[model samples]
Target: MLLGYLLEIVKDRDKAEEHLVSIFETIPQHIDRITGDGVNTWCELQRLARTYLAGTMYADTTSEAKFPNTANKFSALMNDEQHAVFCSIYYYGKTTAQLAQELGKTEDLIRKALREAFAIIRKAS
Candidate 1:
């Protein structure tokens, strides 16, 4: 699951595998937080991976990032706006404010779209 998620983000098997190992290496430091009650482990790990990659491959912002196909399972359930909000925030480590500015949307609306996106993902799960 982690590798699949990483693949969706990095789109390179070698890089994703290398990142998976790097992410796993930090697991011990985050074990307690990761084991918390009601925590979505996959989401947390993905968050960590995003943070990790943000400092590495994603650090150079010269080129724009690419999103997964909108028809991918989770995103297909969302409207175009929701998918954009979710992918920018979730996959690219963008904050709601950043997305709002980039999308020319109000922060509250971006947040609402993010909420709806999460609801769709949770329902799919």
Candidate 2:
């Protein structure tokens, strides 16, 4: 359960390590606080802490780095179709087929848009 939650929260390995450190350091104190309350409190504390850590990690990781200037350059170069496709895939988490249907295009066209968008972004980087 913890591993699955971590995977959702941490996009990369380095961020996962940082979050793990933060969680481990605080967990002992959290455990001690609920010790005398019995099994129910202990279990509740554990579950709460786990969920809290996942949210904390995601916020910290994403909020630290603003989009770079290169990202702006890449965005400026992208046409409307490319922008929509990229946003649907990354921000909205849509599958290629879903994006295609929403955009009234074929799946292959959506895939091409995604490929072109990434190529531009990669070049900018």
Best by TM-score: 1
Residue-wise C-alpha lDDT for candidate 2, range 1-125, written one tens digit per residue: 33333443454557656655676667677676556645576455545545565355233222213212222466678887887776545433457877677778999999998899999999888
lDDT string for model 1 (1-125, tens) is: 88887787777889889989999999999998787899988778878888887887654332234676534678888887888888877777888887788878899999999999989999998
Runs of candidate 2 with Cα error greater than 4 angstroms are: 1-71
Q: How does each model score on TM-score?
A: 0.80, 0.44
Cα lDDT computed for each candidate against the true fold: 0.80, 0.59
RMSD of 1: 2.7
Candidate 1 global CA lDDT score: 0.80
lDDT (0-100) at residue 104 of candidate 2? Answer: 85
